[model samples]
Target: MKNLLIAFLFNFLCLCVQGATLDFAFQLGEKQEPRLDKLLPDVARQMAFSRDSKKLIAKGMGGTVVKWDLQSRQKREISRIHAKRWFVYSIGANQLLVRDADDNITILSLGSGDETLLTNGQYESGSLSAEGTLAVLSKGDNEVEVWQLAKQGPKAVKTLQTSFPVRNGLTLSDNGQFIAAAEGTYGDGEGHRTAIEVWNTINEHPIKVFNTGEILGVWNVLFSPDATMLAVDTQKNAQSGIRIWEVETGRQLLMKSGFEAYWTRALAFSPTSDSLASGGEGGNLRIWDISEGESVIWETYPTGIQSLAFSPNGEYLAAALWDTTIQILHWGTSHER
Candidate 1:
């Protein structure tokens, strides 16, 4: 009987391990082939995949934005704004936001190519809400302003005042219910601390602030699919970790490595809200289990990872890297090994 009981325990442990291993099964999806040497020179600072994930919008070093089709593998130059440093800060299927060195925001319609000046004020960071209803722009030390995007143009809706100066990272929830702004620095500094401010657009008041002392600098923040949790990256102390916080309770549920010491450049929550994908320095891409606080999958390449996105069905993951290449990865079915 003692031997039988021991055997049962061993079998249980084996099953647990198998289940954990089956949680993440990764495969290669579509390959994005871009003519790096001929089409563009230097590195890509920002990239946005179209709403249907069929095309990509990339902004290179010289303020040039190009639209590339994945199916036909064709590339078209969208914008060649003559600025000291031009960047397409945000992109959507219908619209694109370009920022120049002079601190001007230009909203361009992809369909008509009509350009409109949204803001002339200098902004350190900015992001468009998932629904495209609001555009949040940050300026100077502690000022954040939200602009309402209408059919005509953008209008300032609300403004937030922060306690300290913020670096360039801002995220909006898909439902347009909350905005998570990263407030801090990347390297050694006295005010290097990570704080996530969750605010409601209706009330225009912050619901809660998740502060991580002075050792961590919030690099990026993302909301889960259901908008129930918040994921943020801390870059100070030569450490990078993702902390999951309950939106309602402001309680931290899990904290997982954000992939070595490299800064987490982009983060995306899976459609099912069961996992998260983060891309960062060292060309590393990592996926973590939301509930288990474990890294279920990871991949490394030659170029640094700049952005990441998960498919609507949660079956595929897409990454935009510094090597001027976009990669699509397939999530395999889970099974016992």
Candidate 2:
């Protein structure tokens, strides 16, 4: 009977493996098998997949940071060093940055468990590069500051000043060459902001100021893996849209509209930058080819997605949901029954 059970499991996994051949994101209307539904200490405000792939770090506004082993699913609390009211600002290969209640930045090394203070005024929003060498932080009003996280500590690298007020968040390219800033002229109740500017970190100047030319706003800003493209999404009731632009020319490469972005936190490009996946307020997960515009290639369940991150090898997508559960979409294999 044990041998028979083993044979059944093996055959089931093989069938699931065949199912995984389809691009998981593009499998519209297909049931998305839950790979890992991890519970968190608190509602995850944001989460990141470490480049090392050994750890998955998640944090919430309640000043809790939890680290879980991607393979073993072992949970460990590492929120000992953050401020009273802190939010995870950025996650690097082996480091984590937090914004404390006092509005200062705390850089923590995962290996040594050492906390380094980076006092550079009040940083409300920030992004750390993949290499963990550079950080871009934003103050109250569209004042973006860049710092170098060198061996000595974080030092002032550059400053980017914008004409409008910052609306949502700031994102830095993996190479740390470009920074995207979301600025708002006005905000509304249902998550509406204004335009965004992609600035070259080299000179701290805006390369392009993007506006939707309609009654919409750009919220989350992200750069493609190769750093040749920038993507931004708008959030509102019945006025959802996502756009991708050329990095050097600021040309609109693609634009897809008519989706629900309200209360949805899904925007991540595959590690190869060939495709993009987004989860919406309506609990729908969609994937699109970067080269194709005005079309969705695939979709999945309507789970209220709050945040998303891709594994270092690009095999899995970790989604932090509004339901206080972290769902991992392992683009391949069906180890869960």
Q: What TM-score goes with each of the models?
A: 0.78, 0.79
Candidate 2: misplaced stretches above 4 Å?
Answer: 1-41, 82-93, 187-193, 214-216, 236-238, 261-263, 294-297, 300-302, 332-337
Q: In model 1, where do residues sit more than 4 Å from their true spots?
A: 1-42, 82-93, 185-191, 257-259, 313-315, 332-337
Residue-wise lDDT of candidate 2 within 178-220, one digit each (tens)? 8888777654653444777888888857888877544345546
Writing each residue's lDDT as its tens digit, candidate 1 over 29-59 gives 2334434344234345566566676666666
The local distance difference test score of each candidate is 0.64, 0.66
Clashes of each: 1, 3
Worst 10 residues of 1 by lDDT: 20-29
Please give the lDDT score for candidate 2: 0.66
Worst 10 residues of 2 by lDDT: 21-30
* Candidate 1, lDDT over the whole model: 0.64
* Pairs with steric clashes in candidate 2: 26-298, 28-299, 283-302
